[model samples]
Target: GGGTGMIGDPGGKTAERVLLDAETVARNAEAIATQASTLFAGADFTLLNNADWLSQLNMIEFLREVGKHFTVNVLLQRDFIKDRVKDPEHGISYTEFSYALLQAYDYLHLHREYGCDLQIGGSDQWGNIVSGVDFIRRKTGNTVHAFTWPLLTDKAGKKFGKSESGAIWLDPAKTSPFAFYQFWLNAEDESLGEYLLKMTMLSKTEIGAALELHKRDPKERHGQQLLAREATTLVHGAEEAAKAEQVSQVLFGEGTLEGLDADALQMLKAGAPSREIQTGTGIVDALVVARLASSKREARQFLADESVLLNGDPITDPSETLGSDDFYNGLALLKRGKRNICVLILK
Candidate 1:
């Protein structure tokens, strides 16, 4: 799979991919392996790099043994391949055209060395998965299985797992646990059920209960909350999932500021306006400092309107002062309304 990744899977692409250099591919493969180790920690599976055998393949021998089994006519009929061939602007390259052969060989090698008989992938890989099954049967005269599930897509038919920022990454370094959790937290109501079924390991009974609760009040977003929790837990572990959920609740004004660690507060800081203020600062001054109000006069007006909150509790008194007790782990939150929040850092 690592070797195949280098050439890039052309199954779902509209144009030829820029091939990865050996060093980049190797680094990516290693990083993927590291992530997989944590993701599949308790699973009964062995990870293998396809490059172990694929890199050693002799071109002539591969053509004779693997390539000979596949016909150009069949390859040309693949949906992606056909689309590429028909599009003059982005025609398929020989390197990409041979992707199926390489993937087929991966299956053959796995079958011979590991007794693997089943290959599962997205529907987009239907052709490649079938090619593997057929190659295995042709090479060893043994039947294998290919299973493809529908790819998750948005209502508009574009693929899921991408945000306005860019493609979501499993690595927290690329997409923080908070960002990852938010992606699922914001799942559309129409697709929440499918996301729960495909993206989470929740049992049908559990999902049904969540859906029932959500139906009672979609405004509660119970289904999305459940999906977000389960999906985040699956990828980032239970502890981080809990932290992400807590941060989300705090940001949304549904949770208290107590018990948030520095990392969680740091994440919260990123999404809200922030300013430093001295201890015992008056609410009016704090509001202006945090930019929740443009001026002390306006800040007092907001407070008088009961539209201000200090650490999630509505504060209507301009005289109310933020002291050390108000800061949680050196940070506090100010709010003029549900959506306008600011982080207050102790100075």
Candidate 2:
């Protein structure tokens, strides 16, 4: 299990962090741990809380034993620390200043307890990692290694998170698997190659072939599809990834009513605008009730123009009625034009 060391990090961030309550931190730790367990299910892993050990250490003892290995000159040389020290108004706090040392101590604790030698993190942690490596060598005279992966970003160099709803969470409750899948499915063409190799477990040969396939038919999105499925499965389960793909096809790709399970229906119902209508409601009235149209006149006009569809089938008849028979398992899907979608619940 990897420890949640970066949760409170203020490094490279230009502002002070809003502190989270202990209960909130615990809940978030549990959620992040659950996601990690799913992502690395096959491996022997444990989820560690930095507060568990870090909180137990006496400040004086830490400064005496661990802190003595590094000098002030070296500590002040880290880019983020230098920037913070130089800033006048947005100056770093003692808590923020010692964060690197605390992280370095976390590495030493883990190494001593579990023989975990290799410390892997984002590129921003290079300075902190070196501190840990040096500390371990001074204390135990043993060699340790550190590896940092490049930070993932879009072509615009903006962090690859923050969807319309903000940070893309691993918790399905926070960011539904359907939206997560759509995020990858809509990857930009220029960043597709980098995302394919970095974010997925796809083989090099398979990626090479897919890149060529994507080039030949970029509109088909062969590479994006593969990356989407692989990445989604790696985080969420295979069953969820499949359902997400199916939901995509049914909603935006091709239209369908078949193979929709209860979970899939729940996702669709939660995502689309919906209302419950009586059994005898006319289609035009239902349309207005569902906000597919502003008025009966507009609803009728939509029908006349052949722009209204019920369950993906266009309804040209203005006099059509919806009853129990028109409902699929008590839910009816409505579409106006090609994009406006609504779900109607039959009561």
Candidate 3:
């Protein structure tokens, strides 16, 4: 249910992870919990901290109970182990070596305690999942199932959320709703099908129909649009998703700011070039201050050429000053030419 396994991971890097302290782990757990709740909203679910059971596990008792079922040869042959075993200088540690055993016992405990029969996770967890299934079978003589999906990846095979920009955090504060929406909106066309199937709740029939429409007109980005809207709504709620989409549209000149809200205003403030200015600050000063223009002369040139847009309207007066009347909910959207954008936060 979580990525805590990464803490004991040997498959990812040549070196062992720098273990997180208790307080840091607990802090991250809260963030992960909030993300999981939103992404799985309306589902009946109970979260578990593997640390609760794993930490208290008795090592000698574990070897006698669960470790006997696994032969050293088979465990040594595991791909993760093979990678480390081949590199004597960076060989695996006992803690990481035994991580799979802890995970196996986890499945056995869930089976005995909760009647949990099926475990689903990424393909990278295949070895751990099998260990659990085998441990449960040897212990209780009951069969459990392990289902693994294809590892979600981009065209270059790098895992999703592990992009060049770093993990796409589920927290809205870390990644604003608008930015979250745009990540999917900007997904590569070749990767859309897999992303649609694995990441969204849309049915095959619907996705198929959309893909067909997209193929005929790739320029419109119908598939990417559907993926963006659905994925954003799933993570951030529909209302926030809509506001993000609206903010994106209004900023891009494709739509008006008629429905802009306070949340969207703050999103722009946090994400774009912005500066807090008192009401009635000179327009040229505001522009230079926000870095939309480099100097007063450049700011004046933009104003003269009708390249400055305030709240989606042309600002022709070079001497005009920003006022409360220009702000929407205490923030004003300022644009220079097509791509340069800034926000003036009313103090």
Candidate 4:
């Protein structure tokens, strides 16, 4: 249920990554536990650190015990090792070559301490998992079971958890719930059926209904809606999901700024693309900086035509400087006329 020494699993023929600093790894471990708390709330889970035992092993003792079982010939036969060592651009490093032994020791230590009978990981981890099982059997005379799920992939065979923007991070600060929802909402039709079944805990009947609806009318976006709702609720909870849904409805639907609370309005603006301004900047300067208008002359013309809105209301004066009062709950809502909106959060 948890990872030990995350020397960063080698997969997809990737170059060896710089190992995490002790402090950074500690922080990452804590953060992962926090995120998992919501999903595995009632499950029996234990977070462990391999360094607890790994750091204590003397070099002579380690070689006599754990290292004796592994041979260089067998090690080089691993797909990751063979591919990386052969690749001209990214030859495998010695530290990465030793990764398997380190990982196997983690399993051995866990078995000795907790009597952990099973290890599970992605299908790609079969070699590593088997290595751990074999090490345990050879050293301790105990049988252990290991299972791995097939790597979750889309119809095109690309991994499911990434997007054009980047990895879909579990941290809200890294990727907002709205953006996260949008990512799933935009899943290709071909992938929706498999994705819903694999990723969500929804029952078979509910998943089947969503899939049927998607097939009947793709434009109705039943799959997208269900994906967004379930994912958002899982990550941010029902309350935050409801708030994000309301915001999306107002921004993309027929609703206006009047429908939003001050805090919600501020969040909306923060989510949008924006530019910051000094305290003394005039409305004209702010408009130009935000690119709502192309030039100062165009900005003035727009202002004169009553085509500029601050917080969704028309502004008639070009000379008006952005004042503290213009900000709704500490965020300035800017719009060219009433349609194109940008939010400015005062620093």
Candidate 3 overall lDDT versus native? 0.80
Please tell me which model should have the higher TM-score, number 3 or number 4: 3
Which clashing pairs does model 4 show? none
Our model 1 lands, by Cα RMSD against the true structure, at 2.4
Task: For each candidate in the order shown, give its overall lDDT on alpha carbons.
Answer: 0.87, 0.81, 0.80, 0.75
- Tens digits of lDDT, candidate 1, 163-259: 4435678898998888888889888888888899998999999999999999999998999889989999999999889988998899884787785
TM-score to native of every candidate shown: 0.91, 0.89, 0.86, 0.76
- What residue runs in model 3 are displaced by over 4 Å at the alpha carbon? 1-7, 161-164, 216-219, 278-286, 296-307, 315-324
| lDDT of candidate 4 over 1-347, digit per residue (tens) | 12344466665546778677777877876777788786677788876656667777787987788889989999889877888888999898766777677778888888889988888888888888888899999998999978998877767787755443356877888888777776777788888877787767899999999898888999878897787778788887777666676666554444555667865665576567777766567888888988898899989998998878776567878888988777545566677853576676676
Model 3 over residues 1-347: C-alpha lDDT tens digits? Answer: 23344355455566676777777777777777777887777899987777676666686888998779888888898877889888878888887887788788888877887889999988888888988898888888899999988887878998764434556878877777888888888889999999999878999999999999999999888898899889888888888878777777777756655576677766666666777888878889888988998999999999999999988889989879887788777777889987898877788
| The candidate that achieves the highest TM-score relative to the unseen native structure | 1
**Residue lDDT tens for model 2, 1-347:** 12334337666777667777777777777777777787888998877777788767897998998778878798788788788788897877777777777778888998999898999988877877878898899989888999998878888887654333346767888778888888899899999899989988988998999999999999899888888898888878899899888877776666575568888988777766789888888889988998989999999999999988887788988788887877777888888886788888877
Which is better, 1 or 2, measured by lDDT? 1
lDDT score of model 4?
A: 0.75
TM-score order of candidates, top first: 1, 2, 3, 4
Question: Lowest summed-lDDT stretch of 10 residues in model 4?
Answer: 1-10
Candidate 1: segments with Cα more than 4 A from true spot: 161-166, 270-273, 280-285, 288-301, 317-321
Instruction: Report the error of model 4 at residue 237, Å.
Output: 1.5
